[model samples]
Target: MIEAPAARAWPKSEAESLPGKLIIVEGIDGSGKSTQLDLLHKWLVSQGYLVVFTEWNSSPIVRSTTKRGKNRRLLTPMSFSLIHAADFASRVHTQILPALKAGAVVLADRYVYTAFARDAARGVSRSWLRDLYSFAVTPDIAFHFDVPLDEAIRRITLSRAEIKYYEAGMDMMLSEDIMESFQIFQGRILDEYHRLTDEFGLVPIDATQTLVKQQQQMREIVQPHLADIERVEGGDLAEVLRHSGLRGRYLQQPVWAEASE
Candidate 1:
């Protein structure tokens, strides 16, 4: 039996090459991304991986888009679409790419698919949205948390306990008229995810399981890649991880700490 070898710890930036992995967590609003991310982060750390967890739209550039969601006003489909696309672009350049290049596994709460689903649902052209995101860094792995609409709504409602502005009244858009729109849009996003996986060779996990269970699986998926990443990018990895620790060197994206306010 040819069993896979165990993972090893080594300094980065001493290697000739490294394959950094990008793990993206994706789902509609109210899905358990936050919980899964927390669990995944802990598990990855346990595995000796330098895991960095950040959420989409949490970057400074993307946080501004939340203004539209909170304004209780309907923006022109095109305007809202462009806003998120720009947000995604800034995040890719500022936050995601740097971490991936440095060799840390980036656990993103949401990603390109958010733009695919949200924009298209508002009657925007999917093709146009794709063009906007053409410049974003694609993930190495994208996990889609599948759940029934009602279940997702329930989960989101419960999650709103802290009352963040983005989470507030998001359920108001769940009327039956829009429910179909949500499903149709969500379906398209999933389809896009499948296509992306096929084209880019991404790993997708069924995340409907409990957070503990999901994260455990996440560990399995990511741990296997670490050894290779280290072997190739170990030297560079150490440097990037080191920079990530120092002030202003790692976080290319503006941390949306204000969003929690």
Candidate 2:
């Protein structure tokens, strides 16, 4: 049995004084977290909130390098963790923090917790991963979608044609069969996620429930955060920044002024 790492200190304290909310979702693949986040994003936008959405491993600066490594099957556990760290850092600087400072709600499909869980499962040191992502601010809300292992496997098998090499944790040599490897790998990740739920106070969602029910619960949990937040007029993010009164590099440009001219 793979030994679970002891819980470590959170990299950063809970974010306070930021006018906007950062909401993130985390779960194993097929746990339905992505679908739920998408639903929440749509609902928030419909309510006229200025929302910025980001996902894992999506930073353009490292996208090609990660892809090349993956294609070549060259990423070791450590290299994979570092590449993802760079990606998250780029997004935090270029995408997340600016939006938060602008008072725009930022919806992340995954967050630092992803690294804590996935990297730990990959045999990387939990302490090192925490330090690597120390620049991250605590989310206002982080929802972990929980599902049974068998159900998660069933969902993935039904949804995908085939699982990829890295996705199956094949590099770890857990099993000869791809499907078995995926099951074992995802199980480890799920275990780490459960550990994180307690350590980080992550709100748990029953992914086995109907989507509508789950989303209803999520919105209820989110409503209090929205009480003071104004919906963006015509869904313009710049409008949120202009009215936010927070000084930052985002406000130095006259893009809004140019548009009004």
Q: Pick the candidate with the highest lDDT.
A: 2
Least accurate stretch of 10 residues (summed lDDT) in model 1?
A: 252-261
TM-score per prediction, in order, is 0.67, 0.87
The residue-by-residue lDDT of candidate 2 on 1-261, one tens digit each, is: 111222233446436757778889999999999998877876777667777788999888899999999999999999999999999998888878877876778889999999999999999999888888887888888888999999999999999999999999999999999999999999999999999899888888899999888888888787778887767555465455657543333232212221100
User: Candidate 1 — which residues are off by over 4 angstroms?
Assistant: 1-18, 62-69, 72-74, 161-204, 231-261
Candidate 1 C-alpha lDDT tens digits along 199-221: 44444555567666666666666
Candidate closest to the true structure, highest TM-score: 2
Candidate 2, superposed: residue stretches over 4 Å from native: 1-14, 235-261
Q: List the residue pairs that clash in candidate 2.
A: none
Model 2 scores worst on lDDT over the 10 consecutive residues at: 252-261
Model 1 score (lDDT): 0.56
